[model samples]
Target chain A: MPKNTLGEHLRQQGMSRRSFLKFCSLLASGMALSPALVPRIAQALEATRRPSVIWLSFQECTGCTESLTRSHTPTVEGLIFDAISLDYHHTLQAASGHAAEAAREEAMKENFGQYILVVDGSIPLDNPGFSTIAGISNLDMLKETAKGAAAIVAVGTCAAFGGLPKANPNPTGAVPVSDIITDKPIINVSGCPPIPVVITGVLAHILTFGGLPELDDLGRPAAFYGQSIHDRCYRRPFYEKGLFAETFDDEGAKKGWCLYKLGCKGPVTFNACATTKWNEGTSFPIESGHGCIGCSEPDFWDFGGFYEALSRPTGQTGKNAVYGVAAGTAVGAAVWAMNRAKKEEAVRGHEKLTMDELNREGEES
Target chain B: MTSTEFLLWVKGTGFTLAIAVFAAGIVLRLAEIWSLGRKPDLAEAKGNANTAGVRTIFNRFIPDKGIWDRSAFIIIAAWFFHVGLFVVIFFFVPHILLIDSIIGLQWPGLPTPIVDAFAVITMVGLLAMLFHRITQPVKKYLSTFEDYLVWAVTFLPLLTGYLAYHRLLFSPDMLLAMHILSVELLLVLLPFTKLSHSFTFLLARWYNGAISGFRGVQS
Candidate 1:
């Protein structure tokens, strides 16, 4: 545990009280808290000692790490790191070989049952050799590290929901961090590479409250994942108005119509993309004239094709329709033939003495 | 299953089955009607049956003046419900895409707010119609279980759709799945119930007009 409080550490690092308060306000807003809570967050964060964070990378492409490094304004690597003791991250840590492993063990031992464990990749269960850190299998490392963690933050879709590696024919038997460590409170920041502020926001919430944030059914922080992209989308009016871009180069596309026809998954995908946006509030995927691929949702990779609309049938609809029409035609024709035969039979059986028969039938009745 | 998996199932297998049943039932019913050809009239024709039949298809949309006067509320409510249903089904972007996928034709849809307003109107109209059916003594006697069943099925799609669009009561995926499943139910039930009148009413109108035309009377 750090000796000085977060405010003292930031002050020592040349950060003013006003700037720290501003950062707290940003964090409070990012966590979906009301403006009134900003002061409480500031007070809590200023007085609290910085928490120890142990970041572990397993079967990942380091996109999560890259996203974090590029996080908004205050710069996560610069300010957040200054606030927390990121004891071990092989990519960012200077120590290599045994030295890096020693740092992780030291942090775990020193901050036993208090450190925050942030994992950014899935764990491979097929074979220990598939993924190893310093000769330790991912599963073994996760199990060992989770024992001392106060809480765990699964930082990406891979760590949260067994992302691409666990997609269709999951060869490596890849599983998420939650699958292996269910005993601890797990906060899933799920996305192909989750938004930058979301990551910091979650961390800031933990720092301010000294506990995990409220989560959704999927174990994601409800503050960020509460609303879907479609609900907050700017182009939603176009969708409501029945205006869509049939093709990428169409007039609707040029006019920035809804991308539902182009297979936008905003309706089902829960994320802050539409509101928080990406790259310093530049724009999200939908704003770039491309439909959202729903990277944040679980098993997004296996939800048929990316360009296929959410309402479109996943099966061979055309062939099934053809079969339906053929069967219908056959049945229709059969019924038609039967009715025609019955009519012809009646015609053939018609008697010449119809009037006399009718009189006789009437008399009998 | 997860909501997404449920959504996929409804969009895939459920949709296919509903379409097949709807298609077969429609075709079979039409074939049965066509095979029962009308007997040729021995009397000389006073007017063109074709012209009269086509005219009635459009003209029957409005009820006779005396009937309208006696039950103007019912007539107006029924018309609003129908017009609203038509606008929502044909002018909504998502519904249009579904239609285009099946029929290989596309048309520009009305704005979303317009369609949404129309959907609300349709629901209100349907409710008024139902109230009239239940309270009006003659209509209540004439109504059958099938009438209420068809009404429920039609109302479900609209209600579920509105809820899903607004993301109410449930998760977005769950709401969406329910909306789609409701539509599937409507499609499957449409052919077997009095809802088949959507197609059969045209034939009935034509027949009535043709008979009137043969008698040299305006219908």
Candidate 2:
């Protein structure tokens, strides 16, 4: 969504408050919060608290911020964080240079061990020379800022699992946030640039529950990453019946059958996309007629192509044909059925005729 | 009215419930697989195409070079039982009759002698499996009540099918009903049991074989 609110900007361009409130309700649900949480979310918006936040964008595309801003709220993006002040965001904050650096310093001291440190990309630790922000290396800035932060949220896959930058031949030696801060509790919300609602949902979870949701072995929240998308995918029924989409544009694909043969990793990749959805709960990559890229898992980028063969092809490529043996088996089975039927028919026919003859003899006598 | 119909209804129902019982058996088997065999951590490294686990196992499972290698006889026997059961169900006279009016196949069946022979052969093979399960020490250790239940459930259909066809020990009607009912019970139990593995075997086999394939080794 590119972090552009259709609010005052929308109002200036002409949008009604009624339409805006409806949009707010939509946003509330997008974050997967109960409708009851709406009033509190609204109240937080009406009485914006200005919670201090230090947004550190490292080796990233700024897509996370872009997604967050694109939320179709009634300026809810600005309003939600209005309760919490976003002290420094490289892309959003107008101020730069010594003034920008000065604001970060003051905010850190004021919210010491209390501020939310939102990190968007991986830190280059190989030489600390790979990525530098405002004269300080990303590695140094992260360490320094995280020293007394209340929470650290690794925003993108880069900061979550060292992402693409750490893929093969990774010269920069990028590392996820968990690798750096041993003392603090860090929430790694991974994705190429994770779904916008997931980002805010994590924030709301922290705000409402006062503790992180149960996490999986990979440290992803079990609420979202617990079940394999494949297990619950709508195409599962088709797979059970052996209906599969051989190609992206085929008839079976149009009918929404399984994409397993075309290398859909939904079978193994665990995520909420199938249920929670993307594009404002509109459609995810799989529903859009393309296979999942397994973007939610670590090292997904380096894992190779989306259409690459599955881990096992044992049953593919005529391996199951059983050829002479399979044909022989089928023929034998068919013959067996045929013979059983014929024998039963002949025996029953003979017995019926014999009984009739005996009855005839009894009648004549 | 036909031998195949009774077998289909028998097996269709039995194999189905066998699925549920099969599921439990698989979970129990997994417990043993975990304890008995060397298992690599599939979590850290996925069973992807480029990985060691999936690739190494694919060769043994996907190829046809070993169908009759004595050890392969067990698998061949398994296949025979499966094929025999399936043909008896789908291509059987009764099932055909049930759908014939709609699908319009109108195919004919084999004579009585051949049907009797197949019934006897199927029963024999099924007995061998039942015996093999009882005698194999490792399999015995892994066996559970559900496993025995599955074997019995599988065997009953074949027995009842033969009896129903022969009309040897009981009235065909009574024998046929018993056969059909037992098979139905098994079917209802399928999704909930290990017997479902009769179908899920492909998925599991593919999983293990794929892992081996990725590792560039035979399963």
Candidate 3:
């Protein structure tokens, strides 16, 4: 077994002690830990042996992997990947076919119940033929690989919430990892393509604390998904002030007004995109004059039209109102006719009697 | 279903159903009232009924000094509740967007914080009115189950909207769904209950003022 502490790996890569400490502090802050915990994180990560990470891709676009690897070199995410033993990855691994499968099998056996299993896409339960790696079905491979994992990391919205594949009229019957795996501690890092730092930040927390971080209601790390994107967005002031962009190039848009009027789902979406940002803290979707599509939330695709305002209905409400008016008018006219008939009946039934008739009736009695 | 899915349902199908019911009920009730035509006046006209009716619609917004002095608490609470409800509903950005979608009429909205303050005031005012109804002997005696039901339905939207805005008591999506659901309930119930006063009060005030004006008397 190859045994190397992360400290030794970093040192060999020419990362100085000061730089490593800085990285630790950065990681600590990103995880929302106090400054006081920096030393403990540094010590734990330095002394800890590299953990084996088996990356499994099933029914995914390579976007989540690209999100992590595409970061500028020497960034914290790249460094963390360098510090771990990545035994098998379809995209990044040098091995091919049998060799890659062999490496995965060996890693699972060598580090049984110790390796971290990172899943990037959803699992197809409909048919084994739908998604396969080396002729092994995604479901079969997942069930096999998940048996020995210390903890599972569902890396993107696909793996977390059965993203596009599980959208309306889902053909492949794709489902999230949690739908199948019920016995392990699964940490969901949900986004269309999760922010790179957030991906690394979660791994770092595990590396330093040797346990999963606090999770929110959806099994997402609370540190990143605790607050809503709208709450932390820089454009929040515009929302509060009621300045909204009516169109793509309107005055409000030019003035950096809130995109709420443009179908922004920021109010309902919870993610670190607004604060942690993308492209290395450069900008997120909302900052670029576009509304949030709520990529992080479950069933986002089926919620409604992406360009439709969150406050607006997805169906033909106007048509419904028109029909309602027609129906109401019909009912009203009928009721009116009935009431008029009743009144006319009462008038027709009215009887008049004179004092002479009453005197005659009294004499007869 | 997930909270997001629940939210979508309320915003979509549920909203459509509520608006349809509201529109139909209003039309039916109005038709029923208008069908009951008033008796024609045989006496000579002493005043212009049309002018008096239009004037009374605006004038009835404020009560006479005698009535105001006798029911100051009820008046103040009711006014605050009404004004607050109006501001929060029409001046809030999200609500404006909703209305604009339906009617194609857009308007600028007050700042969110200002609307939020109005929501709080609305809730407080509603609570005060409810308390008065329960505590005051005459009010308690006169009140029916419909009165309390209307009070609850009216107050729920304000409460839920406030909670959703602050993201309190539940997840953001869930709270927002609850808020929309509450509003939909109010719409569905409005036409059936005395809450129809929102529309009927106009006709009622006009009728009263027109009658008084026709007799050359102040109403």
The candidate that wins on DockQ is 3
What is candidate 2's CA lDDT for residue B66?
Answer: 54
Tell me each candidate's TM-score. 0.85, 0.52, 0.93
| Two-way DockQ contest, 1 vs 2, winner | 1
Residue A312's lDDT within candidate 2 is 22
Q: Is 1 or 3 the stronger prediction by DockQ?
A: 3
Cα deviation at A325, candidate 2, in Å, is 25
Candidates in order have lDDT scores of 0.88, 0.65, 0.90
Pick by TM-score: 2 or 3, better one:
3
Identify the superior model by lDDT, candidate 1 or candidate 3: 3
Of the candidates numbered 2 and 3, which has the greater DockQ value?
3
Runs of candidate 2 with Cα error greater than 4 angstroms are A1-28, A36-49, A72-75, A312-365, B1-219
Question: CA shift at A340, candidate 2, in angstroms?
Answer: 53
TM-score of structure candidate 3: 0.93
How accurately is candidate 3 docked according to DockQ? Answer: 0.80
Please state the Cα-based DockQ of model 2 relative to the true two-chain complex.
Answer: 0.02
> lDDT tens string, model 3, A52-124?
9999999999899988888643467777887778999989999999999999999999999999999999998
> How good is model 2 by TM-score?
0.52
lDDT of 3 at B164: 93
Candidate 2 RMSD to the correct structure: 23.2
The regions of model 3 sitting more than 4 angstroms off are A11-16, A126-128, A354-356, A359-365, B39-47, B214-217
